[model samples]
Target: MFDQRKQDSLAAWHKLATQAQQWMDPEQQYDELLKAADEMEEKGLITSSEWRQLVRDAGSVFTGSQEHKTH
Candidate 1:
């Protein structure tokens, strides 16, 4: 059971990371990352805890992008 969950978490992270690299715009990437995380969770690809971690990580990463902030 723990092994299965570990696999799921790794898969989720890889998928989300790949999607994250598709967009150069931080805001758009953040939006799409959240959407992907939602889809992954809905499809049982990830646990809710994993989804929340992905959200928090993405938020912190993208939120720090220079392009995302207004001068």
Candidate 2:
């Protein structure tokens, strides 16, 4: 009975780990960051100009534009 329960726990752990790995995908992370930025803008945490800059920077990160990337 103990061995069976251990096996079940291990299987469940593997499933959760797999899901976590998938959830950390780079594109997914970028989208999530954009959504968070939107929420911040809605909450008035940042100005309109700042939000625009955030979107532009995020796009540059994925698109690999050196102009936007450099200081």
Candidate 3:
């Protein structure tokens, strides 16, 4: 079991929790997320292909859960 609600890694956990809550919010938009992805890509934190996948993931998140396609 988790020992505390706030931990040494609170920032990371908080980010994940916030995203999870937002994903379930009907009014939630990907504006900020897309912007962050763009910034990351521009800063070379993520490659072009990785950024494309991030965009794809955002689409899947907005359209409901994603189903992996069998090869």
Candidate 4:
């Protein structure tokens, strides 16, 4: 029925919104950013120089003197 489909769509949207909210959390944001950086490096999206700069910039945002430790 139309009503049922609408309800299902709403539920799916709500779940996605919740997931988006979780991804917005600070820790999650950091993790996701690191993942993206790693992926970029692996896919050759950024040169080593660019990646180092990105890491330095991102490290500055975090607390502690340790630099961003990439795998």
Candidate 5:
């Protein structure tokens, strides 16, 4: 029961993570995500480490901004 619950939780996490990754686009999505993170940090809703991890995950999804061209 406990093990099953743990597995379920992990699966849910993965699904959410994947859905988040798919939203990286148009720059606005990243901007909105960062804004939310900033608000969360300001409100003490999330730790610095958590914010950093979110930024890293967002970076992985978007790679770079449109202003910057990758060679």
Candidate 6:
């Protein structure tokens, strides 16, 4: 079973992701995600690998938003 800290981490990440999706500015969203990921990793809420994955996923969001903007 996952511990409290692990559960808290998942909850935090889920909240962040949901909020990021609602932002009108993709750059701002991506930046926020990176910042949050850094904070989470520093607090040991997420692993380095998870941080990398978050960054990669943020890039995808940024790119997709840009494409929509150009269309």
Q: Candidates 3 and 5: which is better by lDDT?
A: 5
Top of the candidates by TM-score: 6
Off by over 4 Å in 6: 1-5, 8-22
Worst 10 residues of 3 by lDDT: 1-10
| Models ranked on TM-score | 6, 1, 3, 5, 2, 4
Comparing 2 and 4 by TM-score, which wins? 2
Count of steric clashes across candidates, in order = 0, 0, 0, 0, 0, 0
- Best of the candidates, lDDT: 6
Candidate 3 stretches greater than 4 Å from native: 1-28, 65-71
Please give the lDDT score at residue 42 for candidate 6.
Answer: 89
Off by more than 4 A, model 2: 1-23, 65-71
- Residue-by-residue lDDT tens digits, candidate 1, 1-71: 75786577667665655565555577777777788788778878778998899889778767666444665
- Top-down lDDT ranking: 6, 1, 5, 2, 3, 4
Q: Rate the local accuracy (lDDT) of all candidates.
A: 0.72, 0.54, 0.51, 0.49, 0.57, 0.75
Please, what are the lDDT tens digits per residue for candidate 4 over residues 1-71? Answer: 65575455445433433353444644554455455556556766566776676555445433222243332
- Candidate 3 or 2, higher lDDT: 2
Q: TM-score for all predictions?
A: 0.61, 0.52, 0.54, 0.47, 0.52, 0.73
Alpha-carbon shift of residue 56 in model 5 (angstroms)? 0.8
lDDT (Cα, tens digit) per residue for candidate 3, span 1-71: 23242232333322533465445452244454566567666756667887787667666654553232122
**Cα TM-score of candidate 5:** 0.52
